[model samples]
Target chain A: MKFLGVIIVCLTGGLLLYGTTDFPDWGDPSSPASTHLSDYYIEKTIEDTKVPNIVTSVLADYRGFDTMFETAVIFTAGLACFILLRDFRGKKERFYRHKPTGVVLHVKDGKKTLTVGKEFEHMDKDWVPSDLIIKTVCRILIPFIQIYAMYVVAHGDFSPGGGFQGGVIFGSSLILLAISYDLKTLVNRIKEKVLGIFAALGVLIFVGIAAICMPMGGNFLDYTALAPLVWDPHHVRALGMLGVEIGVGFAVMAVMAIIYINIVSEGRHDEGL
Target chain B: MHWPIDLIVLTFVIFCAIAAISVKDLLGTAILFGAYSFMMCLLWAVMGAVDVAFTEASVGAGVSTVFFVAAVFRTSRRTKD
Candidate 1:
């Protein structure tokens, strides 16, 4: 404990302060970030894609390959989480968890073993937890939060929101459920198996959209080839970009949620995967 | 959206990160790290990076926190000197 305190004072405190210094001076008009590769996207994207939102253009069309890998990053994270945390016991092997011999007790039922650590405070099994009120609120809030995340994705062509934002919002909504209710509920409701699938599918969606352009294509993600029937290639391009955003959003949300779940529930146990 | 509010949010973020990393207790640090993510979300929103804001909020604030806690479980609380 004392060592960490000293390390933070010596190392982290200064670095944290350093990281925030000036920080591009808050949308400086002269900043390169506000000017170059993005400037082209901002100006040309709306005309080419017919989407008012410029960031979406950059993410999906201009540098979509980056987005695809970003999705893969999430996919890898999910895999890592599963490998780190998911319990794997052959159906025949009886579950035996190391409990704190003096105080911790283990109760097994079927495939699950709930450990009671010595330091754990006893609660009546039937008692509703204190966070239930917040849980109730989350139950009500989840649909709205999810809907808003989707809206962020759908409207990425218009304004400030896009895949990464929507993904975070989506992931947070699931986290709220875990926090307010219990992790067990979230695990049950959102199966670990499903999250892995979505992560992969997200990458596929982005790559698939881009690959379509190659055949009748101008470039890897040339949206004009997508719907040759559409008189305005811009509109078709915009639609394709939207699809890419949806994919990215799902991948990011699923993988992040998985990471959190692994850390919170199983990692603390300090057992080998 | 609000400048002062945003500044406050940013300040809180810095504070949390400092607290999280600096704290002697690993569990405390892990929990504070979660708070840092939530604050970062607010900072992203205020900066008009709504997409990054949402991602930070969800992953950093919510899920990442859980992951850290779980990681803590698998490891000892004390940092080996």
Candidate 2:
């Protein structure tokens, strides 16, 4: 059976390779894809949206519906992960450590809870003492990483990065905190409820901005309709794209954190890597 | 000039893909998958898709690798097949 599967895979691969032979060369000027709308986008993106980055304008403005749905899809993914993996039931066992003495305590009873003061710190079941250097370095570096992420999101109009990339970077910074410190640090710092709210709020922001256009005498996601609201009407479309990018950034960041937390903790929301 | 770099990156990508699948340790597989993603990101950059390259680098190489590691940390390290 394995041999048959391998043979089938080989045949499929071969067929795919053969099919690629008829494809246009890379960056062919007259290719169907390039010839269709690429010229118009390249030529008029700046004039239309006032965003220097053609990709940003095209993604957040010209093709607004696609991106709106894409954000919704990411939100749905987080929602699904929450529904499938989130475990509300309390765990029977818990562990805590005396911060000064380095003594560990195990509590078998589920109902009894500790006061959790500065003297005692939560510990994972398979916990090891996190290295001081790593923690210190991450502590110092996380802010810069976060700032860079914000820069990427804010400067999407002029740069290569946009919301998705920036959001992922920001989310990874949070995950780095979890890995360096512990899952509890992350969960305690940013509550699960807050994460869920941010995820929904991000999608809402995108939809709200788009929907607002309808009542303002323009089509959905039409930035021109929002001209009256902003101080600089000439760059209203750029501002709209910026708002949309921020929404996507929020959604992606929250979803990344959500998925990471859920998977690491196995939905217990207590102890994890 | 660009074709050589693209070809080299593509070759590395294919190697990484095959190695990731064939590796017995799931942790190793995750790392290899990250290598594959980085190579693909490089290829995208070479092809003049800076935006795509940025997405690939962050989502594929940066975060996804960490996700894979978290998953492996929770689950078994070795694969059955």
Candidate 3:
């Protein structure tokens, strides 16, 4: 199987290298990619959408339907991971270890509840002691990381980052918390059901904004038609773009967290690696 | 052509890619792959695609690496290769 994989990869690389021979010189302004709608997007994005970042303006405004679908794709990934993983059936037996005496006790049938005292603590079968340095540093840094993620999402119009990047960063922060502390710490902070709702809400927001434009008597994602509702016709596209980015951010964040949690837990949230 | 920096980074990228695949330890491979991603991100930044570079830095070097590490943690560390 590995040999076959190597052969396939080599073939694909060869094919790609052969295809690259017909490509224009690097950074050529006359290249098809730069000569096509990219030129128009560069020249007119600021004026058309009142957005300084041409990429965001083009992605969320000019080609909004595609962005909406992209958001849906992220949401679908989160949903798929949730469906594939997330075993809710409680474990038949729960185990506790006495820290002081080094004695292990197993509770059968979830009938008896063990009091989590200073000496007694609930433990997974294969549990590693948390690292002090990692836990401490991450505890201090996660909030700042999350704030930066939000800033990236909000300032996509003026910055290089957009919803997708920002959302991934945000989701990564949650994953970091899980890594530093444990999956229980993460699950306690943000429930699985809440993440599911967030994933769906993001796609709904994108679709809702596009659907709103339809009733306004314009095309599906026409922000110009939103002129009557908002104060300025020129700035409405920028606002619409921001809204779409926020939706994308939410979906991507939820999906990334979902994938991480499921994969780490191996479909059983009872314990995480 | 300002080839020095680009060539150096590209060389490192290829080296890391090969090293990652050749490594027997899956966790080590993941870290090397992350280094390769960082190099790719730098190349993109040099090409003036700040947005693509940013995405690669955050997603490729950051989240994907974490995911890879988490996956390795769940499974065995040793590989036949």
> What would the per-residue lDDT of candidate 3 be over residues A1-273, giving only the tens digit for each residue?
989999999999999999999999987899988889788988898888899998888789888878888787778777787788777777778888899887889898676788887988777768778889999999999999999999999999998999999999999999889888888788779988888888888898888888898889889999877788887766998888888889889889998988998888876775685
Collision pairs in model 2: none
Error of 2 at A239 (Å): 0.5
Q: Which is superior by TM-score, 2 or 3?
A: 2
TM-score of chain B of 1: 0.86
For lDDT, candidate 1 versus 3, the one ahead is: 3
DockQ, candidate no. 1? 0.49
Q: What's model 1's lDDT at A141? A: 99
Better of 1 and 2 by lDDT: 2
Q: Please give, for residues B1-81, the per-residue lDDT of candidate 2 as tens digits.
A: 777887888999999999999999999999999999999999999989999999999999999999899899988899987
The local distance difference test score of model 2 is 0.94
**lDDT per residue (tens digit) for residues A132-246 in model 2:** 9999999999999999999999999999999899999999999999989999899999999999999999999999999999999999999899999999999999999999999
- Which scores greater on TM-score, model 1 or model 2? 2
The Cα local distance difference test for each model comes to 0.72, 0.94, 0.88
Task: Let me know the TM-score candidate 3 reaches against the reference structure.
Answer: 0.92
For DockQ, the strongest prediction is 2
| lDDT (tens digit, per residue) of candidate 3 on B19-61 | 9989999999999999999999999998999999999999999
Cα lDDT tens digits, model 1, A152-253, are: 888888877788778878887887777676565677788877877887888888888888788875688777787874565548988888888888888888
Taking all chains together, the TM-score of candidate 1 against the true structure is 0.72
